[model samples]
Structures are given as C-alpha cells and as structure tokens.
Target: MNPSSTLSLLRGICAAALLATATSGGPAAAESWPTVPDELFAALGLERDVPANVLYDAVAARFHDQDQGYGKGKFADLWEPIAISRYFDPGLYEGRDNLDFEVQAGECASCHESVTPGWVHSWDNSVHADLDAIRALPEDDSRAYKKEHLAEVEANLRSMGLLAEGQPLATVGCADCHLGVNVKAGNHKTDLRLPDAAACGQCHVRQFSERESERDTITWPQDQWPAGRPSHALSLQANYETAIWAGMTQREVAEGCTMCHTTQATCNQCHTRHEFSAAQARKPEVCSNCHNGVDHNEFENYMLSRHGIIYQANGDKWDWDKPLSEAFASAGYNAPTCQTCHMGLHGQPTHNLVQKVRWGFAPMRSIADNLDHPFFAERRELWVATCSQCHSPSFANAWLDSMDKGTEQGLRVVEQGNAELKAMYDEGILIGQVTNRPAPPKPDEDAPGGFFGLFWTEGNNPTAIEYRNAQMWEQQLMRQFKGLAHANPGGFTYTHGWSELIGSVAIIRDEATRLREFRELQAKVRELENAADR
Candidate 1:
C-alpha cells in the first residue's frame, strides 16, 4: 500500500525464499544474473518451482513499476525477455522428473558420444566444458571470475523456477537453453528446437545488450512500426539497404536470397549454436550469408583477393577445428579468412568482431574517425599486427591506409547529399527534419506534415522529394563505408559504392530542384486564384 510497507514486504518475502531453498554451493555474486534475487519471489509467497502462468500473475500484481535495475540497463533490460517469456507453453513442462540438470547435462555426452559423436567430442574439448581449467586460473582471469560467480547464475535460475531445489550447480545442459521454461508436469521432449536469441540472451547478458543497442539502429527508412509482414529487411544498423530491398525491389527467390532470420537480433547468426563450434565461426563462409550482396560484397572480393586465393587452394588441408592459441593457424594460411583480419586469429582472438570498426555509420568527419581516435588506433594496430603475422608491416599499413582514404573520399559525397538536404530546409521547402533517431512510430494520419526520414536523421512531413533525397544518401554513402570496411575497396569506389553515391547525389539534387519549382508554381496558382475571385 505504502512505500515503506511494500519495501518491507519485498524484503521479508526474499529472505524466506532464500532461507527455504538457498544453498551455499552456487557461485558468488560477481557472475550472478540480473534476474530477480530471492526477495521478489519470497515476498510474494511463491515457491521457486511455481508454474509459469502463476509466476506471471504474481509479477503482474506486484512488480508494477518499471525498475531501473541495480545497475543501468543490465537488470532492467535483461529482465525484459525473461518476463516476456511467461506466456510460453506451460504444457511443455508437464509431469517431468526432479532431475538435476548439472548432472543431467553431463549425461547428454553419453547419448551423443554414440549418436552424434563428433558434436559430443568437440564440446568435450571446448572451453565451456573445461570448467576445472577455468577455475584454476587467477581470480582476475575472466574465466576464473566467471567460475567463481555460479551462485548468482544459480539464483537467477532458481528465481525463474528453471533450476529446481536439489539441482546441483553448473547447469549447462541441452534443455536449460534449448528447451523453453518447463512446468513440473511433463517428460522432457527430445524434439525441441533451437533457443531464441532472447532466451540465449538471458545468460549471455552483455552480448545481447550490445545487440539490442545495435538493433535499435537497424531499420530501413519507414513511416510505420513493425512495417507490415514480409517486412523484407534485416536490421543491419543501416537504412539504405532496407529502403532498396523493401522499398524499391521485389522478391526473386530464384536469385537465391531471402530475409529469413531478420526478426530478432539472432546470436546464432554467426555462432550456429547447439555445438556453437568456434572453429566453424572462424571460417569465411559464416559471414558470406549476409555480407555478400551489393551493399557489402566482402565475400566476393575476398574470393578475388590474395587471401581468398590461398584459402581456396589450401584451406581443405588446414585443420578447420583447432584451439585458439598463438600458433593455431597453419603455414597453409597464407591468406586471410573473414576471421583472420576481423578476428585476428594469429594473435589475440576475441568475440567482439567489430572492435576495429570504430564507426559503423557514415560521414567520418573530414578524415576516418579511426585516424585520430586514441582507442581506435590501438585496436587497428592490434589488427595490423595480426596481419603482420603473414604480411609485412609496410604492406599491411599501405592497404589499410588506402581503405582510410577511400572512406574519406566517400564521406565527401555524403557531405554533398547532406548539404543538398540542408539547402532544401534553408529554402523552407521542407517543414522540418529528423536526422538523429528513426522516424517516430508512424504519425497518425490526422497528424500534420511529412516526416524527414533516414537511417541517420528524421524530419516530419517529408514530401516525396524529401524522402527520395535522403534515401539517396542512405543507400549511396552507407554502401561506400561498408564496402571499404569489408576489404572490397573496389566496391567502395568504381563499381558499386562510389559510382552509386555520385549517381544518387545527382538524382537528389535534381529532384529537390524540381520539387521546389513545382511548389512555386502551386503558390502562383493559389495567388492567381485569389486575384480572380477579387
């Protein structure tokens, strides 16, 4: 009812839940989840093994306020998908046993050891399976830090009722992620499918959060939210492709491409989970799926590059599945894979693939942002050092420098389109503009004015002239940046990227002039009509 009473109840209920089911065996707070700690459940008089629907009802009744987690976005946003999953089929968990997944997950190896022997063996040797090795490292080591923090992970599971009482720690199992939240009623189904990225995100909080941030910016210039089904574009942090793909073109499935996995920020886009084999992700093919089109044709360019040439000849001999170490790659790796340059397999390897790509968006000042960026230079050098594993420093620096120059040249074109738009606004042709955020969820029809819409900027009541002009820059300039970023400088210059930018800028300027003339004629018509009436 009151603030003090609600806080007191929340406190008391949490204490009871913890006292009733809590164990000292799980990992500590450092590696814990942003999930509801013991207090929320205990305060509500709900058991850890409560049904999904029942839990949802309680959460709806009690957690009415949108809490801004203990940290910033961690707990608040982290809880979003988990809370949203409450409506998942409760019948799926019908009448299941009190099996502990920590032990049960281990048994998955036995069945797989015979049936899917390769998967089991590969997983056995994976870093995920080697928890003991992780535990033995220094506390400061990230793996060691993760090992020491099982208690929080366990608490998160317990709160969700996914991990029941008497279940041991280390709950990595087939069902934990693969299966949706299980009610206590049914046998575990073997035919279950892949976990949604949102579910995987519950545990892998950081990656998912970055994806959410990236997802925020991933959309085509549109006038509406959830743009009607068959909404053909994936949110790739750019709008031009979306405009081109959805706005300009029609599906040619015979062309052998479709927007299949664009719905949510899929983590498995690269990882290809179940096994989540690192070696598989380290190859070039994983990226070719989405990166090969007109926008960023790195895969096709790599096939032509010295790196791709070598891999084509010798890749089959190189061990595709190897541990990530200083000398993991063979001498046969004379050229780079997508992973070789972006991932830096020759030196320090990391999952943060876009670290070197400091600015994903366009108009990188008069120069590339990476040029003067203190943080960016270190990361870029690290990549070049990896390149130096095969290429000499002079060779690597020269190639990279060319890419930087190409990007600057591309930016000049973007500046032109931008300048054109600015001039239009100056002439009072456009009512206003929207450059920063995506256009507001489609304005009500009764609402006034065209919206100035682009991936980068926004404006209201954007006439056809305004819309087409912005589309020109979004498609053209963005292609230039992406092409260079992908090692296809040609794509950035003559063929697709630069040529397109130049063409689009001309189109934008011409259209803006035509629209102004049309508007002026309309004004004259209105003035003449008034005089005739007089």
Candidate 2:
C-alpha cells in the first residue's frame, strides 16, 4: 500500500473509534469500574463520582499550566507527580479508549520483535512478561510475594476503572504504557505516547505514591525554593527554572540539562527500559550517570570512600536480585552501596529518596544552621540509626557531627568569597562591573550574577573575581561538603573539594589586592593630569 492509502486507513480507524466512544457511553458500551475507596478520592479532593479518565486528564493538564492548582483543587497543597512538561503531548490520547487493548500486545510485539530485537529480548527476561511464571511459583517460594503484589496491582487498577471487567490481566507491554487508554484510537505513528510517572502509577501505585511524596516532605523556610525541590521529584523543574539553561541560545547545550533532570518524565533512568531491571538500578553505577561532575561528584567521592571500595572489589559476588532491605543480612553485602544508604528509611528500603535527606547533595546550607529544627533533627536521628546498623550509635553520631562541621567549614569559605566580591562590586572597584559587562539574562537581572553568570559572558562583566566566587560556592564548596557527606576524606581534602576551594580563595585575595592597586594608580594619573591643566 502507498503512504496515502495507509494514511486514509488510519484516519478511518480513528474516526470509527471516536464514534464508538461518543455513541457508546451507556451501561453496555462503557464499563463502570468498581467503586474506588473514598480516602483515595478524598486525598485528591475529588468527589467519588468523577470518572477515572477525567481525573487522569486533569492531572496531566496541571503540568501544562504555570501554577498547578494544588491548593485550589485540593484542601492541602498536595503534589501530583508530573510528566516532563515539554514531553506532555496530549494529542497522543486526545480522543481514544482502551477497547482494542486485547490485541495491542500482539500487534506491538509482532513488528517490534523484528525491528527492535534488543527491546523484545529485554522485556522477555523481565518479570513484566513472566507473570504466569511468577504466579506458578510455590506458595513458600522466596519470589512468591511478587505474584501477590501483581494480584494487588490488578485489584487496584480494577477498582480505579483502569482495568475493565472481563479484560484479562495482561503482562505490561509497550501498548500498555504508550497507547494506554487510547489503544482503540491509536496507530503506529501519531497516536503513541511516552508514558510518564503518572501513567506508570496506574499499576505500581505504591511506588508512584512514594516517589510523589517528595513534594510533601518537610521543607525549611517553606518559601526559599519550591517544596520538595533539589530532589528527583523537582529535578526537571529545576533545570527549566535555571537562568543559564534558559539564557543560552544554544539549544543543544541547554537541552543537555534534561538528560539527568528527566526523572519527572519517566522512571527509566534508574530502572532502565525494556528490562527495567531492579538489579541494575540497585547498583551504584546506575547513579553515576547523573551524580558525577565538578559540582556534584557524588559518584567520584563514593568510589574513593571505603564503602565504594568494598562494593567495587566484592559487589560482583553479591546477589543483586534481592531487595535492598536484605543487603546486609542476606545479599552478601559487606559495605553500603548508593541505594543502601539513600533509599533506606524508617528501617526499610523505599522508592522515596528524600525522606532521610538532611543536607541533600549540594551546599545549600549546613545542618549545623538548623540542627534543632524538627525536620532536620528527626531525619538526623534517622541518619544515626541508619549508620548504627553497621557501626555503634556513638560512632555514627560522631561521624555525622564531623560531617556537620565540615559543611559549616565549606559554607564559611563560600560566604567569605561572596562577601569579598559583593564588597568590591559595592565600592565600584570590581573589574568591568559598570562598563562592558552585560546584565545576566532574564529572570536574573542581578548585576554580578554569581551562579547565573557562570553560564554566559559578555565584555568580561562577570570578571575574574566573579568567576572565582561562583566556582568557590557552586563547584568547590559542593565537592567539599558532598565529599564529607559521602565519607571520602581524600575527596574532600585532595581530589577536588577543600583543596580546590582554598585555591579559589587565594586567587580572589590576590586579585582583590591587584585591583585596589590599579585603582590607586588611576587616582594618581587623574591628579597629575589636573596639575598639568593648572
């Protein structure tokens, strides 16, 4: 068939699907889901009578807007996990239903198995495809719980009207995510959707809820940054909100920020797609993709730490398939991995990564600044308990104290640099402050744009001193505090942390002295010119 013929055929099919959806709304045509629990709808501040499809669409639209109607829709400012705003293509499922889902798996696989064999192979090995095999396991088998979980998921979907009556529970396949409720109206070309976190939440409800809980987690000041910021929950938003990312006309360079910040779009970064292997995600290497760099060298610091050293040497021997809760006792783990520390909370492993986070991964503020605040104090105790799993309570407490001190130390250096630069800018001696230097890009009109100026330069406006100041706070200070947090002493002292900070400070001091002398020379020149005129 020619391209024109194929297009005609797809249009015909889509028209028929829309007619069916519109005309067939009564009891026989449209199926009603079991009544969902009241608390669930109550949480979203919705009446129970609202259809599942309506709620789903509204949630997607929230991300499309400037301010999510958090308090308007719900009594409290509850967060609905969002898709990557740029990737939210509503046209994919504009007018569709899942009536054709029965044939979706076969149709998707028939072509993809040949065109993308690796994807097929990976999915074949994943538990998503082996539902029957998991169900067949003996009652007492170690993996039997997975079968129970699947059943629970099925029940949840059914209650929520996502799984229709008489629709057999099927393995999670391409169409389940991509075509979703729009399977009946979908074609290979225009109808496919990139599944977001909310789409995945349709099945893995608990995990989705946990990930979204980052929004509700305690935030200090309640106003400095958005709630649950500086975390995976708001990572993509942070990228979009960044002045440098928006200011750069070079889109390719700017979009690179999305490579790591896209956690809001899909969970595939950690749980890689096709296979979506939990084992792969459990490893520390998975984190290195985004967590390594000059500013946040978490991966590098962890590698040098004693914990990382043990994982590198003996991790292969350890069982990667087991849950992290079993790491110390049953998984042959002699030391902590990235997941072991960050994901563990309240005595169990969880999908929420920020529950126990105190200082976070950056040098936002030292824990010493708010040690007594309930939010930090409670989590601080949890940290001690987490560490005390391997070491004594006293040892954990002492080490955490040391980390706090290190954080304060790094913060002081950064503060000092900022103060010195601000002084120069105020006194009108800073190089290029008033002249050649252009104001930073929109949303950041501040002169001497510290961090924002790092991305752009014009007429040497963010002079040498400004550059050094941004580096000291943004890059070196981050490394120093993060290094201490990760337990990499060499990382903090030598590699790229405190040692680098000291160097930046020295440069700033030397530059300040020279600038002052240059100003003095200018004054003398002006005085000599006046004498000549007389």
Q: Candidate 2 — which pairs collide?
A: 437-461
- The lDDT of each candidate is 0.49, 0.68
| lDDT of candidate 1 at residue 426, scale 0 to 100 | 68
Off by over 4 Å in 1: 1-173, 176-267, 292-297, 324-331, 366-370, 430-468, 518-534
Task: Compute each candidate's TM-score over C-alphas.
Answer: 0.52, 0.81
**Residue 221 in candidate 1, Cα distance off native in Å:** 28
**lDDT score of residue 506 within candidate 2:** 83
**Candidate 2 deviation (Cα RMSD):** 12.4
